[model samples]
Each structure stands twice: as structure tokens, then as C-alpha cells.
Target: MSIQTELTEQLNRYSVDFIRFVDVSALPEEQNKGFPYAILFGIALTPEYIQEITNQPDYIQQKIKREAIHRDEFHLKERKTDRLADELADFLTQKGFTAYSQSEENLAQTGSYNEAIQQTSLPHKTIAHLAGMGWMGKHDLLVTPEYGSAVSMCTVLTDAPLETVLYSPEESMCGECQVCVDVCVPGALKGKTWNIKTSRDEIVDIAHCTTCLRCLVMCPWTQRYAQRPVAVR
Candidate 1:
């Protein structure tokens, strides 16, 4: 079997639900730190838990908060992301390649305000999209066909000999829909549609985001129905 296929099997054993290898040669040499390829993996969220948001207002809010804990994978699962990344990195290294896994925790924290990327240790979502996993949602979160904005991602960058995919970043499907915009209690969402070039500030006010969970609850992908009632004028 090909190296990529073999690696997939190894990752699957670790509960990695999504896996993709991407070419990061075009990224700033420092961002990738000279790693030409990146391996991306994601853990899917439970759909049954996220579906609780469609209930009555009080029920929806309570369910969202309770489920958000699970959706974010607060305890064991949160640590699992890093653990799996390391395991994958080790697996790649054993194959005689220079591999390094990036911890999803504290992403950039680069201390640069002008650059959106400086906010995290690494843009795992960037790797996720480049890996053909999913696109960014209006909430500045990754949205996939299967899990919507409910999945968490981790990444590993390496100079491994495994194959790489041509970069075709996923496109946003938020379109003109404004459910996330309308329901945001903090009024953080600017209602702008996302694209490859869209930055967080261009659409949402990061400073104003209250983490209210409205956008998270209103997201159509997390619900059984993919559409929300258009906000009353």
C-alpha cells in the first residue's frame, strides 16, 4: 500500500475521523518552518448533542451550553487532539522523515494584532481547508459537510516522503444567509460571507465576541435542518 494509505490506517486506529496531507511549500517559510508538507486530522462531534438547539428558546440555550462542553471536547477529547497529533508525528518520524506535530492548544499567540494568524499557535483550520476537509464558516470556525462547525482539528507538519495534494481550499457556503449574524447577542458577526481571502476582522468583530454560543447554535450545519428562519426585519 502507498505511504499515505498506510498512514491513514495508523491515524484511524487513533480515532482520527478526518485525515489529509497538504502541500505547505507556498506558506511563509517561517509559518511552516520549512516543512513542505502538512498532515491534517479532525475529530467529529456528536450530531445528536448539537441537534438540541432547535428546541424552545430556553431549551435551546441550555442545551447549547451543555452541549458546547461536549462539542468543544473539554476533557479527555481535547487532550486527545494533541495526543493523536503527536502519535501521528511519531509515526511519520519512524518512517525516516523529519516530522513535527503542532499542538492545537494556544494556536498562534504570536503577539501581532494586524495579522489575524498571530492570534493562534497555528491555523489548524488553514491546514484543514487546504487538506480538502472543509471550509470556514461565518463564525470563523471550520465547517464540514458531515459535521458543520462542530468538529475540532489538529495538524502535523513534516518533510515526509508521503504524497501531497494540490492546494484547492474549500469555498464558503454561508452565502447571503444571516442567521448567525442576526442571532449574535454581542453583535460580533458583521454578516459578511467568507472566502479564501476573507480575514476574521473583515467579517466579525473579534473584540466584541462574547462567546455567547448563539452563532454556534444557529449554524445550520449543526442542526438537522440546514436553514434558519430569516431574521425578522
Candidate 2:
């Protein structure tokens, strides 16, 4: 079996639900520019847990008050995401693929289309390009059909020469759905195009984003399972 196939199978054994490969070289072209690796996986989180966090009275109150608790909660969530990135990288590297986590510093340098797509010390956009995980949204975030703009992404860069999965570039799905823009407490998601820039020039503007997940959890498309009526046993 091909190495890519083997790797995909191995990742699946660990409960990784989706896997896709992208050629390292194909990423420099206009269609694939900015990234250098590709793979996408999601671990299912209970809908109840997601709803609890989003609907928590304290969570809503903190966001409304613009309190420090918002920062603390987001930091905790980010650390968990970072740990997942590390674990995935370790798994790939152990399998003899030269894999590493894409650095935050590298991400900062690759300014989204809202600004100019600047060159970073290490370009890692290939992962996003190859995974077919949706295009660069107007807000400079990766939007997926299943997750909308709600998914957390982590890159796995590898020397493994894997066959690439190609997907047609999708039009912005935020079409006329300004829930993200309208509900942004900090007014970060502004304009018809959903650009990510602020007057302060912060690339990501984490401070502005309370990570309230209002844009995420509140997304109509994100709660697909929640909409289904419970199956009475």
C-alpha cells in the first residue's frame, strides 16, 4: 500500500475521521499559495458540551462586560487546541514522515488577502489548500462545509511525497449571512467582504475576538446534529 494510504489508515484507527494529502511543491502556485502541508481531522465533541459553554450565563455575561475571564477561557481553549496539534505532529513524525507543527510566528507573517499575502519564514498554507477544507474566508479564516468557520485547524508538514487531493475553490459561503459580522461584539468582522484588519494593525486581533464562539456556536450550519429530533429508544 502507498505510504499516504497507510498513514491515512493509521490515523483513522485513532478516530480521526477525515484525511487528505497535498503535494508540497504544488502549493507555491497561485491556487495553492501560502501553505506547504495538508491534512484535516476532527474529533467529535458532544453537542451538549458545546451548547453548555456557549449558553453559559457567566460566559455570556463575561463577553457582554468585556471581562478578563473571557481571555482566561480562550487561553485555556487555545492550549487544548495546541496540544492536539502537537499530538498529531508527533504521531506523523513517529511514522517516519518528517512532520512538525506550523509555527504561530509563520502564520503571522502570511497576511491574509485582506492585507497582502506576505511571505513568512516558513509558509504552511499548503495544508489548508490540500485538505479541501474551504477557502480563505473574507474574515481570513478557513471555512469548511461541515463546520462553517467554527473548526480549529492545525498543520502537519511532512517530507512524505503523498498524492494530493484536489478540490475546486468554493465561493464564500458567508453569502448574505452576516451573523458573524453583526454579532461580533468587538466589531472585528466588518464590511461586506469580512476583512480581518483593524486600525491597530494586529494580524489576528485575538484581543478583539473574545473567542465567544458566538460566531461559531451560533452558526446555523454548525449545529446540524442538534437540529435532529432525538431518537426515542
**Weakest 10 consecutive residues, lDDT, candidate 2?**
194-203
Per-residue lDDT tens digits for candidate 1, residues 106-185, read 23332412354335434788888877777878888777777677666678888877687785677888877788888887
lDDT of 2: 0.52
Q: Which candidate is the best by TM-score?
A: 1
List TM-score per model, in order.
0.77, 0.64
Clashing pairs in 1: 107-120, 107-121, 107-122, 108-120, 108-121, 109-120
Best candidate per lDDT, number?
A: 1
Pairs with backbone N, CA or C atoms under 3 Å apart (clashes), candidate 2? 34-125, 35-124, 35-125, 35-126, 36-124, 36-126, 37-127, 38-127
TM-score of 1: 0.77
Q: Which stretches of candidate 2 lie over 4 Å from their true place?
A: 28-36, 57-81, 84-96, 103-126, 136-140, 194-207, 229-233
